[model samples]
Target: MADSQWVDWTKTTQSKNYRGSGSFATFMIVGPVCFFLGILFASFPYDFPLLWTSDPVAPSYYDQLETHLRFVHQSPPLIARLLNIIMTVGFLGFFIKLFRPSEANVLFDGASLVLYVIGAGVYIANIVKGMRAVSAGVWHTEDFKGIAHDGPLTGEIVLGREDSLRVLSASNTILALVLVGVLVLQAGQWYAERREAEDNKKADQADKEAAERKASASAGSGGSGKKRQ
Candidate 1:
């Protein structure tokens, strides 16, 4: 009976989508975003003072700022490239799954992809632009103009430095929040899939028990007839 039940369960599971593999693919897509989130969080201490404080930029701050800027310049581009590669792979997998004749939850994958694209868009549109501005040291010439500048210091526009830093910090904050949203969406997908698997398992068990009871009743009826004869 146990063996029969196991065989029935295996067949039932095989008839459905390969959800475990799908979930693994989804994680691969999300993994880099999570890493980016960690980077953003870890930089808060280095970023907050430069962004929020009204105190004059001390000469000593330049060293720390340079270190932070160097990291900002180097890390994100690599991370973004990695993210793009992973997203491409994920999309390929999604298409393959969609074409399969199984009951795959394509909707979840579609929604996740949409959210991830939005997050990527946000990063590219805002964060990447900010990074470029910082790298070129040309923030004052772009964007807002109505705000009065603090005038030049050390033969360069001090306000531009502040503005670029602000842009970088603000963009990072927005990207971090967007990544959080992506994480939440993935979490919900995982939970829904888990619940679905449990439900399927229960249904399979119920069907197996019903089949066993029906067989037992038929056997009993046949024996009773033989005894009467």
Candidate 2:
């Protein structure tokens, strides 16, 4: 009963759009995925068999794992890339809310699901494409061969595939930017909503105070009338 009244009041005052809920949902989903990716990239080289390379500073295994460096799959990618995945779930939540905007979303948080799944999908696809460079054996930019240092012994270690990797990175960057921009817009909406709620609360409180003042004055006049009679 008390819960229902509080809920009813919230429904009347707040916007039915629950898209904002997704922002936080995306945050949770993206967090784990990025953590996993961080571990994957950080550990993959060490776990794989030893590869002998002459480059003093660069670890041979690290150079070899470069075969898997993707624009949206590395440390930098983990940041916004993971976030966008979570945002996808949030967006989905918004879509569902349109059908039943006022309903309680206690069990399933749809917005988070949509944003997270979509964002994760993007990261997966891009990362796989990066791995493809190795399987294809073209030794393209992401291919370990491309980044290998050139010297008297190894002539342009990657053969010749700079343009391709640059293009792949650029394309993936665009995808990330699109998803991140959507999240940023969501944040803006949340800020606006919070402000609106504050204003409404203040207005409601003022109205209640005015009513109380009026009632007090009316009771005082009635008591004076009785005394004079």
Q: Write the per-residue lDDT of candidate 2 for residues 92-129, one digit (tens) a residue.
A: 54454433333333223334344445655654665456
Q: What is the lDDT of residue 36 in candidate 1?
A: 73
lDDT tens per residue, model 1, 127-215: 67656555554533665354434455433233445556666677777778777876776677667666878998899999999999999
Worst 10 residues of 1 by lDDT: 4-13
Q: Against the true structure, what is every candidate's RMSD?
A: 9.3, 11.6
Residue 213 lDDT in candidate 2: 94
User: What residue runs in model 1 are displaced by over 4 Å at the alpha carbon?
Assistant: 1-24, 47-67, 74-104, 139-164
lDDT (0 to 1) per candidate: 0.62, 0.49
Error of 2 at 201 (Å): 1.5
TM per candidate comes to 0.63, 0.46
Model 2 misplaced regions, further than 4 Å? 1-99, 102-131, 139-160
